[model samples]
Target: MKFGVVVFPGSNCDQDMHDALQNDLNKEVQMLWHKDKDLSNFTTDDCIVLPGGFSYGDYLRCGAIARFSPMMQSVIEFANKGGKVLGVCNGFQILCESHLLPGVLMMNAHRQFVCKNAFIKSADGTPLKIPVAHGDGRFQADEKLLDELQVNNQIIYTYCDKNGNITPEANPNGAARNIAGIRNKAGNVFGMMPHPERATSSLLGNVDGVEVFKFLGLN
Candidate 1:
């Protein structure tokens, strides 16, 4: 599988994602700058990451402004064509802002940015790495969207404890419905708040996150 990690001005994890995919997972990967409007040059199969970071200094509410980037237009088109896209952290915000996924990220319900290694769950048979860190991580949408997510099995992850059961206190950003990760209606596009790339290898301290790639059959 070929992996393209999108890079925006303030995207700190762009290289980290690239290293994890190329070095750890041994997949073909490259960094696609946000300015590059042509992504058709790199579409082979299954995997492109919007990576985590404060794009554009988080000036207009996380990914609100990033949705208009030159490259995202092409990205939207790519995803619509059935390519898999993974949006982590701010990238998740971008997915929501781009309307590729449902809902919006709000400041943590606590009204503060949060950074911690929290546990989350996958209701399906897909096993995943369990821990990740981030701020601005809460997910919220209306009842209708929530209903739609459930009906379609698009809710891929939820905050939970080591036992794999969700806990109210574990809701780090007070995400509605404990939403931690989501997939597009087609199930090919995925976005989450966790940094799976950072946790993929033991040298980085844990291999739990490798399954995010594996779940997509990349690993």
Candidate 2:
């Protein structure tokens, strides 16, 4: 499937996402501008990606401003129509702000920007070492929403240790239930805090990030 990476003002990781999807995964890719509202070139089978970055300089909250972008309007419609969308880091914040994904990305528990490798595991206990970089990456939701997410199997990934054990020490941002990533109930939209694109290259000494794409059915 084709991949379209949106470029919002101040977006720093758009190229990283493009390279990972095009060069590393050998997929067709297009750089979609935030102002462009057209998405006719793509289909429901294609995936739209919101890469990590400090959109709008992270003003008015991490992704608060970006949700109103022209491109995001089209993205929202696309996702509502069963189109696949993936958001990473700041992009994940946008998804939450747009109501595409549940929960909010709050400030890190330590109140410090975290930029380091973090371990996260899938529901089946499969572990992947991915890099996370953000000050407001902690995920929080009310008890009712948490139970709904659990019942719907919407929680996709949680913080874990190298041995694939979920633990408090492995939680980098103190996300609720150690959640590092999750999907919408429809399973077409995904949001995650880690920068999987950063680990997709062999030069990075880790290719575990590619697994994230695979999970999205992109590879």
Candidate 3:
């Protein structure tokens, strides 16, 4: 399926995601502007990606302002209709703000911006080394919601070490349960802090992110 990468006012990773999908994965991709509300060209078989960046200069909150964009309205409608939506970093924040995903992305435990490579593992113990860059990347949710997520198998990825051990020390931003990524109840929408697109290219010395895309049925 083709992929569409949304570009917001301050988006910096839009091209990165496009390159990963178009060049590395050999998939068709389109750059969608935040002001454009039409998604008629894309179908349920396609995917819409919200790349990492400081949307609207992170004003009001990380993604608070960007959620009301005309394009986001269409995105929300698309997601509700079972369209595949993937949000990374700030994009993840937007999904939460839009209520497309549960929980909120809070500031880091140390209240500082973090940018580095972190290890994360899937439910089956598949590990990947992906990069995370954000200030408010910590994910928090209510106990009830957390339990529901775990029960539904919606918690797709969690922080871990190189050897695939889950520990507090391995948690980068103090996300609750070390949650690095999660999917909606229907599994059509996904939100994650770690940047799998950044790790997809072999030239970067790590292709573990390819496994992530494969798991998402992108390959």
Candidate 4:
């Protein structure tokens, strides 16, 4: 699969995401500047990746303003047509702000940007590299939407301890329903607050995050 990684002015994870998808997953991946409107001029087999970073200096919010980038306008159109989209960390924030996915990435309950090694229990049988990093990653959505998500099997991953119990402390950034990540109703689009690209190497201590990329056809 060919993956497109979007780069905003302040996106720090663009290179990391690009390299991970290219070298780690051994997939054809390209970097698109935020100002680029003609992604069609690049690769065709489509999969979109939104990487982590303090886009626009995290000024208004994690992804609040970055959603307006020219590339995003086409990203929304692509996703509506059943094209797959994966948003990690700040990318997840952009999805929420654009309503491409439900919920919001609010401030951590402690009102601070959180950065640390973190583990998220997978609900699916597939294996993956666990996620790490983030400060304003608490996930929030309406109760009705939450119920719908569960009923549809859209709640792909949840934050939990080694035992897999959803607890307040286990839920980093205090994401609502301990939702570490989720998929759209179509299951084509996925957004998570954790950085899967960062977890692809055992030398990094864990390879739990690689499954997400594999799931999207990278591996």
Candidate 5:
């Protein structure tokens, strides 16, 4: 499948995502500028990616301003039509700000930026080591909404240990339920704090993250 990696003004990881898709995954991928309002070239079957970075220098809030980018309107429309949209790190913040996903990414409970390799486990019991870099990585929402997500099986990834154990010590940003990633009720939109692209290559020290792309049926 083709991939469109969004490039916001301060998006530092766009090229990394592009390279991973094109070189590692051998997929058709292009950089989509944030200011561009058109997404006519991308079909519903194609995947749109909002890569991680400090968009707008993290001025107002993480992803608060980037959500207003001209291209986001089209991204929203595309996702509403059952298109696949993946948001990584700051991109995940953008998705939450845009209401494409429930809950919000608040400041890390520890009041510090966290950058490290974290072990995360999918609901299906698959575990992977992915890198997470962010300051506002905590996820917060109403208790009812959290309950709804659990009942719907929308929670996709949670911080875990090598043994696939979800424990408080494994929680890097103090996210509720140790959530590292989640999908929308429809499952077409996904948002995650970890940088899967960076971990896809063995040259980077690990290829555990390749499982995420393969989960999308792209690998």
Candidate 6:
């Protein structure tokens, strides 16, 4: 399936996502600009990616301004119609800001921007090592909502040790329950703070993140 990488003015990782899809996965890709409103070329079978970056220079709040861009309206509509949407890092913030995903990404408990490789585990216990770079990567939500996400199995990834043990010490961002990623109830929309796109190539440190895209049918 084709992948569309949305590009906002301050987005720095759009090319990373594009290259990962086009070169590594050999999939058709499109660069969707923030000002553009049309997403007609994409369908339910395709994937729309909101790449990582400090959109609008992270002003107001992370993803707050970018959420109102013209193209987001189409992105939201596409997701509502069963299309797949993936948001990475700041993209994740945008999804939360847009209410496409439950919970907010608060500042790190350490009160500092963190940049490092983090180990996380999928719900199925798949181990992944991905890079995370953000100040507002902590996840927060009400206890009831967290329970609902857990009951619905919407939690996609959680911080874990190298051996796949889930523990608070492995949580880099102090996210609620050490959550690293999550999907919507329908499982069409996904969001994560880690930079899977940055870890997809073996030329980088590791290729473990490729499993995530493969899980999404990247082959």
Among all candidates shown, the one with the greatest lDDT: 2
TM-score of 4: 0.92
Local accuracy of candidate 2 as per-residue lDDT tens digits, 1-219: 999999999999999999999999999999999999999989999999999999999999999999999999999999999999999999999999999999999999999999999998888858899999999999999999998998999998999999998889999989999999999999999999999999999998999999988877778
Global fold similarity of model 3 (TM-score) = 0.98
Query: lDDT tens string, model 5, 1-219?
Result: 789999998999999999889888889988899989888888888999999999999888899999999999999999999999999999999999999999999999999999999999888867799999999999888899989989999998899998899999999999999998888998889999999999878788888878988775556
Of the candidates numbered 3 and 5, which has the greater lDDT value? 3
Deviation in Å, model 6, residue 128 alpha carbon: 1.2
Question: Which regions in candidate 2 have their CA more than 4 angstroms from the true location?
Answer: none
TM agreement with the true structure for every prediction: 0.94, 0.98, 0.98, 0.92, 0.97, 0.97
Relative to the unseen true structure, what is the C-alpha lDDT of residue 116 in candidate 4, on a scale of 0 to 100? 65
What tens-digit string does per-residue lDDT give for candidate 1 at 3-97?
88889888988888888888888888878889898776566375778999999998969998889999899889888988888899989999999
For each candidate, the alpha-carbon lDDT, in order, equals 0.82, 0.95, 0.94, 0.80, 0.91, 0.91
> How does candidate 1 score on lDDT?
0.82
Model 4 per-residue lDDT tens digits across residues 38-67: 667433347888889888888887788899
Which pairs, if any, clash in model 1?
Answer: 129-208
Q: Which candidate do you rate higher for TM-score, 1 or 4?
A: 1
Pitting candidate 4 against candidate 6, the one with the higher TM-score is 6
Give lDDT for model 5. 0.91
- Tell how far residue 213 is off in model 3, in angstroms: 0.7
Judge candidate 2 at residue 80 and give its lDDT: 99
Better candidate by lDDT, 2 or 4: 2
Flag the better candidate by TM-score, 1 or 6: 6
Candidate 1: misplaced stretches above 4 Å?
Answer: 125-131
Please list the residue runs of candidate 4 whose C-alpha ends up more than 4 Å from where it truly belongs after superposition. 41-45, 126-129, 216-218
Q: Poorest 10 consecutive residues of model 1 by lDDT? A: 125-134
Identify the superior model by lDDT, candidate 1 or candidate 3. 3
Output the lDDT of residue 165, model 6.
Answer: 92
